[model samples]
Target chain A: MNAPRVIDVRGLRYRYPDGTLALDGVDFHLCAGECVALFGANGSGKTTFALHLNGLLVGEGSVRVCGVPLAASVSAGDLALVRSKVGLVFQDSDDQLFLPTVLEDVAFGPANLGLTPEEAAARAKVALEQTGMAGALHRAPYHLSSGEKRRVALAGVLAMQPEVLVLDEPTTALDPPGQRDLIALLRTLPQAKLLVTHDTSFAAALATRAVFFERGRVAGEGGLPEIVNRFHWSR
Target chain B: MRSAARETWIVERWSRGSSPLHSLDARAKLAALAVYLLAIASTSAWTQAAVAGYAVILSAALAASRLPVPALLARAALILPFSATFALITWLSGDATRALALVEKSFLSGLAVLVVIAATPLTDLARALEAFRVPRSLVLVIQFLYRYLFVVADQAHRMRMAAACRQGIRRNARPRFHAAAGAVGVLFARSWERADGIYRAMAARGFHGTFPALAPTRFRTVDGVFLCGFALAALAVRLML
Candidate 1:
């Protein structure tokens, strides 16, 4: 009868080598099957916080995902496991996509997770279907429209079968229709989601709970509507 | 759907063809071109026949590619300035013949590379670099460059459109060089930030440096014949010269 905490971060602090502070004494927790939005303006440590979730940015505190401590002592093998278990989709689809074809890009994640080519392809197909990008499997990411690229990028991460999704500014360049499709997709994903965004409207639509980030720490946290109204967005 | 359909058509049109030249391994074509280059470089300035023969062979290759001849010509013409620079340097050295030779060699060599590219797909051309002993790192850089150039170009195009929309210029207005420089600076900073995110995505997916081939290439008997035949041809040309 115990609730599962999908992600646990305690006393997180990060400082750049140039002696600039990025994150200071941050603490957070995410539950399984929950959609949480991290809201903040640029340079508000939203990205820095997201990076720590995937072990991309090493910091001074501890992060435990699915009960495994993401400590410095964890081997590269463990990190790979964590990475595969938690997909990190970047803001720019250009950065998320580096392969020649959408299929290849989607296959990249599962292939790296030790899946066979057939298995990877099968997974990629399902992921692309989920994102409504099934027809673009052979198209180059570079050739895709901005909205298509965003969908393809989402598919790339989905193919990894991550238990938790960490998205940075997911709706930044998307059109209204694309944003709706993305929000709908996010609503259906069975995994926990950590969407970092500046779009309060998108945050309002997709997130069940919200965390406000300001100057590198969690400024406030509560239910979605409360945070939105408290932040003074009338909608 | 229209754009997607258009892209699909272009990719298919570029990728599908029935030229004997297209069927040939990229490595063979590249080596042959390299051998021709060496022979052209080694020949006497008076050997216009050799230069002419090189031009004829390259032209035939380009013709065989079935790509638009005008397009190929326009692309080749763009390189004329660099060739002319070499010719000019040779002329200043009091060697008119050497200048002609330099121009001829440069034109032919540059033409050869272009023809090869026109005949072969960029992916095949990249795979062919393996035969040149091109460092894997360099090959990867070139491959990624080719892959991302369109993305960067599209970004630049968008930025230009955005700027134009604000400035009330329809298109292709001559922005000052400093303005262009600022645009480039913005592009670079954006690209660098994107690259950081890309590295994370790549690392998340277990991208080691080596790009894994979707399918393995088989070296069949025909490949062997082509390799041997090209090697023998190069050797004969070397000996004859």
Candidate 2:
């Protein structure tokens, strides 16, 4: 039996205030426990489409996460529920880890979900331990190395217990060993993941399939090697 | 940028220490600071002895904090340029006594604030402010400003380096001034985009308005005792001396 769809989007279109059409009729979906890589150029709207999954960007499209459709007028409760279900690890860890300490930053998401302090801390501890960052719990975010910051940022999202993990350029600042460790870590996670990246090798290491985006649309979709070859995505 | 990072690290390290002052509740420390400031501000310029008493009290608190006295004093002296300007104005108005008092009070106030901040982590201090009914929005602004100050400074440093490399050792003031103006504009735009990115991240994590604390602060009997004792001591110096 096939897994249920965790994320479903169709005909998504978005335009910036300056009249730039970033996402034009994009279609995408992710099945439960499947890892999919989004291959595209810099301005191909992968990030913008990823943003739509969590209701961060409301565009002209239908986005449903874990069976809940994103309403045209997003209520606070609906937005919170969708956000808790789709955790987005942004490109820059500095932008994601805004709290003072590692533990606090990780627990921020859970606490926002209305958990008690002790409960949120427990969740955060589990997430940090899973990300191999339990030792840096009390350290400040700025004091951390780039790899550690990335792990803590991942932990922050994981603490929310999202069903779908959307990582935008996760390998932006990681060294070779850091990337290897990240691949190992991400492979262990069972959540459906959507990786928006240009790193073909990194994508092949974990992603089972891939989609190619071009000019705000889905240009192609197939096996990782097939999509990479078709788009010349490798650097 | 490196100096700013070093200074911030030093203060953060001091806050994490196991000194008695560091162990005290941030609320108690903030209350004591408020009392001390009020004492200093209410003192008459002619009451030079009271001003000295305030200094002595602040010195005792600084000693209790277990931080480096000389370093903190030097840091507090950074306020002198601004205070000295006002002091000069007062002196020119034929109020030398008031002028001296102004400088002394400002220095003492700055030192007292530094002592408290050096002993308490900013997170705990922000929690203390929330507990005291400070507006959540204002507290969040202060916390975000402090957290991102280094990031912004580092960006500015990188921009300067890039501009220097492109300029190739050009030392002309006119060109340098134009480059600086352009850099400022770019920095502002980058900061604005960064702030937007931060908001999106926050929204993705379910942040509504107020930041929830991982560990809620508890006001203990010891904290109460420290607040009362410090406030009484400050009041005594202000009134009796």
* Top candidate, metric DockQ: 2
Q: Model 1, residue B31: displacement in angstroms?
A: 2.3
For A65-101, candidate 1 gives per-residue lDDT tens digits of 8887887787888888888878888887888888767
DockQ of 1: 0.50
Q: What TM-score does chain B of candidate 1 reach?
A: 0.74
lDDT per residue for candidate 1 within B136-201, as digits (tens), equals: 778778867767676666688888888767766445545655677899999999778777777877
TM-score of chain A of each: 0.95, 0.98
The C-alpha local distance difference test score for the whole of candidate 1 amounts to 0.77
Inter-residue clash pairs, candidate 1: none
Expressed as tens digits, the lDDT of each residue in A1-235 for candidate 2 is: 1899999889989998899999999888899999999998889888988889999889987888888889679788888999999999999999999988898889899999999988999999999999999999999999899999999999999999999999999999999999999999999999999999989899999997999999999999999998888877787
Q: Which ten residues in a row have the lowest lDDT in candidate 1 chain B?
A: B1-10
Instruction: Give stretches of model 1 more than 4 Å off.
Output: A1-3, A116-122, B1-20, B45-48, B85-100, B148-194, B207-216, B221-241
User: Could you give the interface RMSD of candidate 2 in angstroms?
Assistant: 1.0
